[model samples]
Target: MGLRSHEQLVVCVGVMFLLTVCITAFFFLPSGGADLYFREENTVHVRDAFIREELRRKEQEELRKKAEEAIPIPIPKPEIGAADDAEGRRIFVKQMIKFSWDGYRKYAWGENELRPNSRSGHSSSIFGYGKTGATIIDAIDTLYIVGLKEEYKDAREWISHFDFKEAAKGDLSVFETNIRFTGGLLSAYALTGDKMFLKKAEEVATVLLPAFDTPSGIPYSLIDLQTGRAKTYSWASGKAILSEYGSIQLEFDYLSNLTGNPVFAEKANKIRDVLTSMEKPEGLYPIYISMDNPPRWGQHLFSMGAMADSWYEYLLKQWISTGKTDDRTKREYEEAMFAMEKRMLFKSEPSNLWYFAKMNGNRVEHSFEHLACFCGGMAVLHSMNEPNRTISEHYLTLGKEIGHTCHESYSRSTTGIGPESFQFTSSIEAKTERRQDSYYILRPEVVETWFYLWRATKDEKYRQWAWDHVQNLEKYAKVNFFEPFLNSSPSYFQGAAGYSGIRNVYDSAPEQDDVQQSFLFAELFKYLYLIFSDDSVLSLDQWVFNTEAHPFRIRRP
Candidate 1:
């Protein structure tokens, strides 16, 4: 009662601080026997709560890791002033893509391909009998890479509404659909970080899954998307084509990685198990394989061409794509390559050019398809990743020799475009024997090899070779279609014509095939553009290209 007001306030603050300390000690710093007894009684509940909290934290962390894994590493855009004429050449290729895309948009719009000469749209059997816009799907990733924002945006809008369930009627080639549609969408998602493309890719893949429901898990060549029923090509005699089934793994495995779904990879891995278990004669797989529980080689013929090329291509690429953790793929790829070097590799007389010949039984056929020209690029790419210096050197040499031989196929031709197939007999070197083999379908293998070689070696000649192809394409393959519909476009676009295949590369003035294939935009122009781009853009270390030239990001462990 006699104390001043200030002294009374200080006394109250001291009492409150002491009370708070006493309360904290009572809950958290037990010391008395009675307090220890109460703590023991509740220990079980406390431990359980702590464990639950830890588990929840771990679950969150795992989800975070998966989300990070799904995020695509952005591809580097081409620098403005790259060395030498690289920027200029890249621009030329970009212009070519624009020209081709414009023609497709104007004529085909939503069709599979453009008949440039006829100025109309056409659908191929590979895509079934409907307007699935195969060209548009194939060109989306290309458009994004070349900075064609408006075109890419338009394609994305169409893709947003594309229904695989109602894509087409009758049989669709599982291989072609996987490569063009699934692969294209996957690559677009990888480059653009767009979930729309990924969703569409999963839809197509799910529809195609029934194709793998075979006794051997080897996919059928064709599947009716509507019916979900699959069957081998009638011409295949109820057997699966090696390339068709084998080439799909890259797409499916990649889909699984992006979606965190293991089923897609399991189905694809089953195909690998079947092929790996089957006995390959002379360590070489046949073009046709049985679809039984234990599959058998359907033919004695062996080739690195049309029916079998991409099988080997995928084997090597799958290993690389999976962050090189797939030792089985690497082993199989190495074994196949060793066998190919021993049995298929040959040198033509006089000209002394290297090539891979086909094998029928024990007989070696001195024949090569333009389709096999991709082997050179495959070799070079494999060499870069190889651990053995000697093997790597050998592959590099082999790649260059093969590249030169393929270039000869074009240089020897009158129109500077290679034919479908060629021979390497005593009298002939890179010359076609059959009239049917002389036609050029605007194939990209030769230029694809040049692009790979250039990237691997930085040799100027590869650039020159690719440039030569561009010049020839501009000269002979260009289709100048003038119509009132195109008048609204710029003056430069009027001169920028759509490209078509030639009836004969041997013709000084080759007749146009009238059709512009989807691959012209997908593989050909894309490869040409990449050839002139900086190495940092889509560097080989960070990505793996599927057989269709659609690049997938490397999935790291």
Candidate 2:
């Protein structure tokens, strides 16, 4: 009410000091002083975005977990069952070789009689399918997996009788000795851990490289081993290109790891580069291509069901092992695989399965009457990472269906079926349009398909299927039960009782279990045993082939 001049002056000075401090603080702050405050606000925005990303990742992890845990697959018992399958396969293989040897001995009785070709097991001379160039290679592949010490030495000696160098020079279109001996040599090395096997495998891979000399960078099916020249255009001419190509790469991959050989890696890449350029429109590849004329060969839009699986498998394996690939290659390959998966794997018959097709634009033109052995191979592709679980499951289901139906209808669920220790379950398809005529003679590939599917799904149904098949084999087919299953004692070895030719040997009503079992028999049964035996998939992670002899030694998580 009656402030003195000194009091009023004090209050005014206090207010003035407060205003001065605020002004000084605002002015001396950094140039982006407003932004500095706003930066704190930006964290709110970032937190929101980060939250969203985490949510998405969580969903993905859930999906992965669901995929991993989905369907409750039974772990395979590879170690325990491996010996059994290996033992069975070994017995079968021994019988096969002995039968051939006996035939060889018998041919001595006739004047100038030639033995069946050792490779293909085809001996037209004895009403046999004629010697196939691929037979010996397959046998050797199996032999390496299951051969005993003495057996391996004998195999080496027998193979030594043929001069592979000269045989490689003779014919290019027909199966060459190089691929044959390469498999044989590699198997030998794997079995014996010997240097000679490695040397021979390398030699074969070196000779096989010239096969990729085409303009398209895709390999020719046949190559002059002597001249390194390209040969004719057979259906599988270009298809055989990758097996040798990838096989060599696998060899090189092993060599690089084992011996630290940079040259082997370099050689593998050289072959890989040639094959890489064959990626075609819509990411699909051609079955045949001329090395010199990439554009001309490119026009023929042919894609076989089996060969397509081979291509994807090779690429996926390479990507997984070498990590040399990029996102683009994987994306392209995945797209191609999805496209093929939808067309061939889904819409194809529940009964007959996929027909070989031509990819014209987005559509396919059906060509073949019989399903090739590759449909089973296609089902195995489901083991990859992908979004569409239904697609993979559907194909796997269809494959099982085919196997079951075939077993019931064609083979009559017979056991111990196979010719010459091999099942001649050829791709049963008819030349005629009728279903009855559709039963063509071939080897039993369904057994292989079933085993692989069982491995992937680990469903009890597959195990039951396998169990039933095993029992059926023991029941109907010519099995020498007298030969004990155990391998520990010499008493288990029984004098060979199984015939080499197909079963239905002397019967008017023949079954499918007869004729020939391919080298793939070991692969089939090995997986079957592993699937049923409560083995872990992690055990098989490091294994490439998962065959009878090499049990999965990799540890599981």
Candidate 3:
């Protein structure tokens, strides 16, 4: 191009000179830092860049460490207690299970339960849904968990052929199946990291989905595992047990996340949301809920017993399992627990023993059960989360009191085993009345709470209490054919005369029930064993136990 004037020509010549310099620099300059200024030494700049890089690298590493800490990591069981003490208890428990299993193997090998005392072996689907040896399935993970390798391997092999599709109809309780079967398999998978347990769990979940097909997302109380058919009671239209609908969330939600299926969590959350949405007095809902028609208020028959115990349990545990991410459940559980503190908790004036009182329309029912004793453990669990030191100590106190009261119930009995249910009337004679609800059946709640408190406090007294209970159970509940009973030869209960299922804890030689509930093996002895073993194995910090005594590891989100 030609310049218009001498002034423009001079500007063009200046620009050309600058271009020539830049071209020369582009060809000759170093690769990294030759953009703007040049013709100067850059030793300081290079040194500064290296210092900045190192600082940046360190900062990034620090940030990575913080991120990892921010994510919750579950604490695993740390070996606790004196080694000899732990081993002794473990061996005792192992033998107990073996002895109990002897009765089971002979009488109820493939059945859900054993009629230990029956002349000819009687089997029944008590809590487990199938006659395909649900007890074996229920006990399998427990065996593996406690390191009973031989038993674990045997049970695993036997269970490999379990045909889930062929499970019988007309003999299933949905609540029981959810707690025992689904919880068991899920727990086993978590421990073994084995996908087989997960696959079987998914099968059970698929079969049970039909129960939740109800209008309100609440499952029916019972279902046939084979047909996906529900057992309809006259009350089945909208009614469901409080704990049944509410407690399955921990197991089912974990399954959902593990399997990458949202359906499980969706249905479980439906129940949780609906239950908490109601206008409850404090946080306690009625023991029953009608899914189709929700009730706002004025139904106060409350207890932390069989029907409603695990609802509170799952709420707190759900908060934990999700790594404290579920704020809603936390709030719900706290509110409900405060309500129980106000309504259900009763400090006896005469006995001065703190016990949870069942309520009937704002009045004290003056009753608690072996099943309800689990609340003390829940209270101890909640204390760990409470930020306020004062409030936390108060909860711990409450838990210990309830736990102590439960143990007293057993100690007061002749057999030193608590009844299935007991009550302390507010009036004269505040002593526990087993006549209303007697019979131990090897129930595990009192001892279970005792174990929790022992772990939390490391108090030697709790260990002593645990020892006494174990000694009593061994003396009274253990079946010895050598002793012929003096009084009509101990009640041959359930028509089977089985050694398990004690009908009377108030007698020197208590009558034995025929039906040995599967949970005796699954929960009672398992808990006792854990209580005596070091608290590190299946520790409370690292695991959450379903109602059926299945342990699930706490995972970070």
Candidate 4:
């Protein structure tokens, strides 16, 4: 039969067909999921049909392999092992808000943060923003997020008492103001339809306009809110953080659109115009850009970490916030995402753990940050805006996988909290190997990603995983103060478990970091609450959040 004679084989096969059937079944369908041929059919016509089906089967197998490689996570029907996680999440969110709100009122009312350990307030000089009383502004929407309407109303009124003209007498961060204050105000207005919040936005924007007086149209980082002068010690000192300049566009553009003034949009869009003219290697912008010299990139650091994370974020968000009308901004985002794909993605060679790597220049630094986890959520949001369905699904799968890696970062830790910074190595030096930054400042990026993934996939597994994060905070970082419990002070001792920051995640029983970032309320818990709630809350297509977790509708420009 191995004679170079197809005619002889075909003639013999038609006469005695069993031999042909056996050969075709063994060769064509050995490793397949389903059988391709029957026991009876073995003539040339049947042989031709089997060959065609087998070729089609092989082609499908190859395509499946490629798709699996592209998106490694399996999107099975979510495991529904527990029903109580949702109820627990709802209870947990409200309880934490009440506890934190009461703590702030007792100790640091009208101040930036509650020092849970010390029960006092001070200039959060560590952040260099110098603005006092930011937590209240940031926390207002979190109360609303959890549907604590009575608390939200009280907090809203409490905030109305602060006079911006006098409150302006501090060193202010352009990024923090645009996010926690301006973004917060706009979100409050959107949620409540209150004119007072809108009024506050106008007042704050009036004072904030001066920060853009720089020649490059990029705003300086710090300004004297009272004096209308930029601080020399901040970005005005011939340096600018890349994230600070790039992150403000969403809030500013929203302000411009709602109010019908060109100035807000004009100032913010110039940063994009400047970005358009510059040279970005591999389509990547460095961590610092000179606000003074728009052409000269500042630091050599290239990362999706803290200093550069939101630079990529606002690019994608700008197009969405503008009702998808801005193709120029959309193109800019697409180019940056191409760079993100090329430069930042990595898998740990030793452990098989997927993680995004930080970069110095063109080299992989093998570093990771809790802050960079926001990229997972941002990736999902980016995919939603994409026109190509196949690519969108693939990116969504990538986001789910990345979120899994971030969850692993927490679960692998003894303290059950993620590190502020960490790195992977190409060594099998230990079975579960990585180095970590010692502290956990209660950042929300990882949990925020969990929310986005769960919301997109409707996977209860993501919700369960986020509840693990909440329990970690409950076990390790929670703190409380009651007036009756510790009567040693000028004021009080009232004990309640408020969500607070930790000094270090590496310590099994670490000391509290004491300074709860405003974003804990603005971002972390809000996302957690939304993930566990019903599907209708902040639907993905209807709303998009600014960098600080302030939600905005996809408004027509």
Give the lowest summed-lDDT range of ten residues in model 4. 72-81
* Model 4 spans with C-alpha error above 4 angstroms: 1-83, 126-132, 232-237, 427-436, 481-493
Winner on lDDT between 1 and 3 is 1
lDDT of 1 by residue, 1-557 (tens): 58899999999999999999988766765566566778886897899999999997786666555554664423332433332487787887787788778778877798899998887898878888978999988999999999999999999999999997796788999999999999999999999899999999999888888888888899898989878889988988999988888898899999998999888999989989888888888898888888888888887988999899999999999999989999999999999999999998998899999999998888888888999999999999999999999989988998999999999999989998899999987778998867788999889999999988998999999998888888888889988753222222233122234899999999899899988999988899999999999998899999899988999999887
- Residue 522, model 1: lDDT of 86
Stretches of candidate 3 above 4 Å error?
A: 1-86, 119-130, 231-238, 293-299, 426-431, 434-436, 481-499
What does candidate 2's lDDT look like per residue over 137-219, in tens digits?
Answer: 43454444433344445545555454444444333532223324454465556555777656666665566566655565445
Give all candidates' CA lDDT scores.
0.87, 0.44, 0.74, 0.75
| TM-score, cand. 1 vs. native | 0.83
State the lDDT of candidate 4 residue by residue for 1-557, as single tens digits.
36668888888878778777877767766454243343333466788999999997786666555544554221121223333668756666666667667777777777777777777774565334443468878888888878777778877987788666576556777787888888998999888888898888877777888988987887788787667888434433477788888888898888887888888889888888898999887788887767565458865678888788898888888888888888888888878877777777777765566666777776677777888889899888877778899979878977887787788778777778887777676553111333336578889999888888887778888888887777778778778542332223332224553566776676688877677677878988788888888878887777889988999888765
Leading candidate by lDDT:
1
- Candidate 2, lDDT over the whole model: 0.44
Looking at model 2, residue 6 earns an lDDT score of 100
Total backbone collisions, model 2: 35
Model 4, global lDDT = 0.75
Backbone clashes, each candidate: 0, 35, 7, 12
lDDT of 3: 0.74
Error of 4 at 268 (Å): 0.5
After TM-score superposition, the amount by which residue 48's alpha carbon in candidate 4 deviates from its true location, in angstroms, is 99
User: Tens digit of lDDT per residue, candidate 3, span 1-557?
Assistant: 76579889899999999999989978776765564335345666888899999997786666555555554422221232323475676676666676666567655676777666662344454343446577777887778866777778777776677866585446476777777878888988989998888888887777788888877777778776656677434553446778887887998899999999999999999887677667776567777766464433325578888778898899899998887889999898888888888777777767787877788777777777888889888888788777789988998998898898888787778887888777776552224554647787777788778878988898878877877776776666656442212233233222112347677777788777766677876787788788777777887778888878888888787
